[model samples]
Target: MGATRSHRIPRRAAHPALAAAIAAAALALTTACDPVGGLNSAAVAVTTDQVATAALQHQHVDIKWLTCTAHLDNGPRATPSAGSATKDVADVTCDGETKDGRPITVRGTVTQEVEGRCVKGDLTAKVADRTVFRASVLGDCTAPAPTTTRVTPAPGGHPTVTVTVTVTQSFQGK
Candidate 1:
């Protein structure tokens, strides 16, 4: 019987610099794909506007010329409970006029989830001195983002003012 010989293939170790570069690339890809982690104050502001408008429309209010602004509350003072994920809370305020020429206002705080769609919050809508709508929205709490129109004055000495308006379609929901 002839002798059988086995040939072993040696494995090469990855260089330290290559490993570090791979790690950095992985981290960058992860951060870029993570919607929750990439949410900034400007994005939160837009989300807040959508949420507030949805809340108002849910109450059958025909909102016009709505202007919304948001402030993020993820500062050092914000602390989540143990075992709970850190949440980004945005304080939102919207002001506009109703179809009937009455002033409408929405005040609330909203939180957007990681799915890039789910938004939950507590909102209150008031027409003049009467509170028309108030609730803790669980899901489907987003509307179309508002649009801004910049009106530039003519070559005269007039000033330029930027205006943002959100006009929601009339909703017939009780």
Candidate 2:
């Protein structure tokens, strides 16, 4: 009997270089499609300067104030009243996006009072005329009121003893 003959096609091994090229292309495509990669593009909108306002309020107190005056602690000496306070603070700013792709900036400040003796060494501490405090997207502008202590020698007539106290800080978002 004649010898039986068998025939089969040989399979070629995958090319290492081809595999590397394909992997690199896939990586490049993935990185290019990332959403954050085009952050500088025109499609990314930004907000502009915006203004906002807020009010400051007091909640509690420990010492008796002369009156609620703008001075840190100035009031009528004859009557015991809560003193008014003007806090040194800056405005706040924020960036936001609207549903329709509009950019917005929000800025605001709060009016509040501080507690303490109004007269100290004849130098009364009033709220600075300039804005010294500021708030940002990640910052706040609330500052405790600054106070000074008044020292008066114990005298035979009406004598005043002054103690330093911080005023309450309050805020209203606007």
Best by lDDT: 1
- Count of backbone clashes for each model? 0, 10
Best TM-score among the predictions, by candidate number: 1
Q: Write the per-residue lDDT of candidate 2 for residues 39-138, one digit (tens) a residue.
A: 1100000001101111111211111212111111212333235464333322222233323333333334222211210111111111223232233321
TM-score (all chains, Cα) for each model? 0.49, 0.17
Worst 10 residues of 1 by lDDT: 1-10
TM-score, prediction 1: 0.49
Alpha carbon deviation, residue 48, candidate 1 (Å): 3.6
Whole-model Cα lDDT per candidate?
0.47, 0.21
Off by over 4 Å in 2: 1-85, 113-174
1-174: candidate 1 lDDT, tens digit per residue:
001111111123234454334433322322222233533333333334444555666777665546655555764433355544566676766677766779877788666532222345677778888998776663353633223322333454322112232122233459
lDDT of 1 at 22: 41
**Which pairs of residues have clashing backbones in candidate 2?**
52-107, 52-108, 65-81, 67-82, 67-83, 68-84, 69-84, 85-114, 90-133, 115-167
